[model samples]
Target chain A: MRIITAEQISAAVAELCIRANRELPEDIVSAMNRAAADEPWPVAKNTLEVLCRNIAAAEEMELPVCQDTGMACVFVRLGQDVHIEGDFRAAVDEGVRRGYELGYLRKSVVADPLRRINTGDNTPAVITLELVPGEKLELTVLPKGFGSENMSRLAMLKPADGVEGVKRFVVDAVRKAASNPCPPVVVGVGIGGTFDKAAALAKHALLRPIDCPNQDEFYARLEEDMLREINSLGIGPQGFGGHTTALGVNIETMPTHVAGLPVAVNISCHVTRRASMEL
Target chain B: MEYRLKTPVNREELNRLRAGDMVYLSGEVYTARDAAHKRMTECLDRGELLPFEIRDSAIYYVGPTPEPPGRVIGSAGPTTSGRMDAYSPRLLDLGQKLMIGKGLRSREVIDAMVRNGAVYLAAMGGAGALMSACIKSARVICWEDLGCEAVRLLEVEDMPLTVAIDSLGGNIYESGPAAYLESLKGGK
Candidate 1:
């Protein structure tokens, strides 16, 4: 069995947290550039330009792209043959604490949803683990800001509601979100499965690269159709108004109970910061 | 047209602005997010004096990252404004003239702005690194225990913003998108 130490995990998590916050991933950069070129309104175009410049400045100055350094969402895909050498959860939280403190990134976590006391170190990261086939442990860090997170929605539609219902719900969510979640946002739609699974799938859909299409022909077309419709809303960049309301619509689905048509829409801002490492 | 606005912007200056006007704001402003606003309102309820003056001052809805060594501040940007809708009308009634944030405000908030001759401005969302360059100085003035959510006094220079909602109730969030959608319908 391949053995991985908690120290190694902690160090890697810290580095990834800092790096992900500062750098705009290449795909996102290219997508924004394309959006800027396609955007028609002058105000929207200027907004996109400023967003691009912000990304560039963040990289050049080694600063975070957005002040909300975000809740550290650590997703781990562990192979069956690997054994972890120490306390896993505590090590991950420690990594986040060190990362936020050392990188000068914001510590945005609170101890409770209602009590609202700052956790100070941005600890107790939202960590998700899944078992995979090989010896490699893959880690992906997605720093999710609450602006968009607050805008996410889920609805358990009856089986009769079908595709049109899903379409309408997704469109309405984006329309209501307007500039709140920071358009041109990424729309992650999860269909089928149970309620919680649908929500999780919707979030996971956001982890896909902006340009990648779903492998399924049906879902791929739905994504395309949704993207076209959302942009047609003219929410534009920063909601100043134009044609590029969303950078992309990504859909992930699974088989669900015959009676249920569960769906969730998780919106992500233009920054959409995420990074991955394999060990 | 771009404007260079100083702090304690009078009602006359605010009334002259309209939705969609670009602005480069300079001078002192205060920072508060959800928690701080709750506390400030509660303090106000108890007849306690706020740490900073509210009259004619601009309040930015932001909780900035901690400053790194040698930098005046860390990445600073506007937070979602909708969350502050509950407390904004009351604050606006209490003589807060300008608010810097991103996103939509409620009808009551807009009505309060119209009634009070206040204005709402939007900084570019997700453009924190660039925005921080405009802030020349920042220091926590109260609620230090709240960390980033503390009330801060900031001196900004040429901080770019767009007039999202004006004193006259001209809301760019509604009108801008409607106009663009209408233009598209006109085949522009």
Candidate 2:
């Protein structure tokens, strides 16, 4: 069995938290560049240019790309053969604590929803673990900001509603979001499974590279169709009005109960920050 | 078109502004997010003095990241402004004339702006690193215990913004997209 220490996991999470905040992923950068090139509105083009400059400044100055450094979301893939030493959950939280403090990233978490006291350390990261067949442990850190998170939506439709219903819900959600989530957003769609599973799948869909297509031919085509319809809304960059409302659309699906069809749309802004490492 | 604006912008100046106009704001501005706004409105309700002046001043809805060494401030950008909708009308009634942030505001907020001759400007959302370059200095004015949610006094130079709502209730959030969608149809 491959052994991994809690300390190693903590240190890796810390580094990832800092790195993911400052750097724009290459796929996102490329997608934005393409959108800027194709955008028809001068105002929208200008907005994209400013976003590019922001990315550069963040990288050069070693500052966060956005002030809302976001909630720490860590996804872990552990091989069945690997055994971890020490408290796993505690290590993840420790990493978040150190990362937020050391990186000078914003501590955005509140202790409770209604009471509203700052957590100060941005701790207790949202972690998802999956077991795979290997000796390696893989970790991905995504700092998700709330502006887009607030705009995400989920709907449970009758089985008869099908693909058309899903499309309508997604398009309506994006329209309702308008400029709130930051336009030129990446849309992660999860279809099928149970209600909660579909929501999780939608978020997981966002982790895929922007240009990558879904493995399923049907879902890939749905993604493309959704992308076209969303851009047609003319929300543009920052909702100034243009042809590039969305940079990409990603869809993930699973088998669902015969009674219901569930779908979730998790919107992410242009600076879709995520980082991964294997050990 | 771009205009260089100084704080405590007069009624005449605000009236002249319209949705979609680009602006570069300078001089003194204040920072307050959801928590601070709630506190301020509560103080107003209690007939208590505000921590800072509200008349003709611009408030930025932002809760910035902590400053690193040798920097006056950290990455600072606008938070979603819709969250502040509940408190904005009251603040506008108290003579808060300008707001800088991102996203849509409620009908009541827009009505308050039209009634009070205030304006709303949007800094590019998520453009924190670039936006920080324009902020010359920042220091907390109150609620330091709230951490980043504290009210701050900031001096900015040429802070870029686009007019999202004007004194007359012209809203770019609605009109910009509508116009573009129409143009798309026409082009086709």
Candidate 3:
């Protein structure tokens, strides 16, 4: 078994936190450029121009893309063929704690949902671990903002709704959201899993690169259709008038029980901040 | 589509602006968001003088990052406006004339804007780095313990904003979408 030292995890986590906070990802940059070029609405195009400029400024200033530095979510894929030399969970938390402090990220993680007490250092990252069949471990850090995170929704629709029902629900969710979630958004739709699994699938869909394909043709078509429908809503950039409402609609699905049709729509704004590393 | 607004503005000046009009804001604007708004409103209920004056001044609903060295502020952008809607009408009634934020205002807040002759503006959300460049100066004026949520005073220049809700009940948030949607149906 290949044992990875705890020290390595610590250093990587610290750097990941700082880098993720300071730099906008390249895939997102390319996607935004493409979206701007393709947007038909003048106002929405102008909004994308501001967004591109913001990305450049953030990089030059070495600041985050948005002031809402967001909640720390770490997804770890641990390999069964490998051994960790130290307490894995503690190592991860230590990375998050050190990274947050060193990065000067906002301490947005609150102690209680209702009381809203800030946990000074953005610690206790919402960690998800899956054991896989490799010698390498992968970590993805997502800094999810409250504006879009608050608008995430999940539902178990009857099988009758099928794909058409899914379309309606996703459109309605965006409509109800209106300007609240920060428009010119990226939408991740997860379908066909169990209720909880669907939600996770939708979130994982966000980790996919903006230009990547869904592999399944039907799902890819659904994504295109959803994008067309959502943008047609005229929510536009920043919810003011424009042609582009959503940058992309991504759908990730898993085979599920025959009796139930579960779906979830997770909306992310232009500031979709995430980064990953393998060690 | 552009007008220069002066602080401590009254009914007449505000009435001249409407939703979707571009406006250049000058003069003093204070910053507040979820925590600061609650505290300020509670203090108002207690009949205490607010840390800053509300009459005719604009309050930006934002929580900004700590400034990096040599910068006035960092990654300053508008948070969702609905979160502050509950406290805004009360403050508008207390003589606040302008609110700068992202997203739509609640009906009650818009109504308060009409009755009190206040205007609402939308800054580009997620455009923080660009937004920071407009802030010529920033200093904490109150609630420092709140960290980024602290009430700060900002001096800005050429900060471009669009009127989203004006004193005349013209809401761009509603109208912009409707106009485009109608055009879409008209196939224009």
Candidate 4:
């Protein structure tokens, strides 16, 4: 069995948080370059240009891409053979606290949804775990800003809605989001499974690289179609006007009960930030 | 029309602006978002003075990242303005003339801006690192306990913005997309 220390995990998590906030992934940069180069609307083009500049500035100046540094979403893929040496949850929260402080990131979490008291340190990260067949532990930290998070939606459709209904719902979600979630957004969609499972799947779908399509031929076509339709809405870069509303559409699905067709759409802005490390 | 606004912008200056006008602002502004607005409104309810003057001043709906060493402020960008829709009308009633934010505002907030001869402008959303370069100085003025959500007094120079909603009730959020769609229909 591979043994890992809590301190090592925490330190790694802390660095991941800081690095993810300051750097734009390469695929995202390429997508932005394409959008900025080909956008037809003058205002939309300008907005895309500014977004590109922001990406560069974040790295050059060692500053975060957006002020809303967001809730730290740490995804862990652990091998069944690995054993952690200490209190894993506390170590993760400590890492989040230190990273938010050291990186000068915004602490956006509230202690309770209703109480509205600031957490101050941005602790208790939303951690997701999946078991894989290996001796290595893989970690991915995604800083999810609420601006786009607030626009995410899920609906349990009747089996009758089928694929067309899923497309309609996803498109409508993006349309209703408009300028709010920040256009040139990434749309992550999860179909099938139970209600909650679909939402989680939709969110994880965003972790896929922007240019990569689902391996399934049918789903890949659906992704391409949905992306085209979203851009056609003319929401543009910052919702000013044009044809570059979304950078990419990612879909992930699983088998579900025959009675229900649960679909979830999770929107992410141009500031889509994630970083990964393995140990 | 492209214009430069020096803050404490008067109603006359704002009156000349229209939705879709590109603007560069150079002057002082205060920053606030959902929590700060709630606090300010509650203080208003108790007849308590706010941390900053409301009349003729601009409030940016932003909660900035903490400044690192050698920086004036961290990535400072506009948050979604629609979240502030509940308290904006009240601030507008007090003669708050300018608001800097991103995204849509509610119908009532637009009506309130129209009533008060106010204007709402948008700094590009998620372009925080680029936007922070425009802020020359930033210092927390109140609610220090709120961390990034604290009210900050900022001095900005040549901060680029677009008038999303104007005093006369023109709204770019609704109109910009509509115009683009219409142009597409016209085969542009």
**Model 2 alpha-carbon miss at residue A157, Å:** 0.6
Compared with the true structure, what per-residue lDDT tens digits does model 1 show for residues B1-188? 67779997988888899999998999999999999999999999999988888988899999988888888988998999999999999999999999999999999999999999999999999999999999999999999999989999999999999999999999898899999989977984
Between the candidate structures 1 and 4, which one is better when assessed by DockQ? 1
lDDT of 2 by residue, B1-188 (tens): 67889987899988989999999999999999999998998898899999998988899999999999988899998999999999999999989999899999999999999999999999999999988999999999999988999999999999999999999999998888888888878988
> Any residue pairs clashing in model 1, and if so which?
none
lDDT per residue (tens digit) for residues A12-34 in model 2: 99999999999989999999888
Q: How would you order the candidates by DockQ, starting with the best?
A: 1, 2, 4, 3
In the range A52-113, model 4's lDDT, one tens digit per residue, is 98899889989999999999999999998999999989988988999999999999999999
Q: lDDT of each structure?
A: 0.92, 0.93, 0.84, 0.93
DockQ of 1: 0.89
Q: Which candidate achieves the best DockQ against the true structure? A: 1
Which stretches in model 1 have alpha-carbon errors above 4 Å?
none
Interface RMSD of 1: 0.7
Poorest lDDT segment (10 consecutive residues) of candidate 2 chain A: A34-43
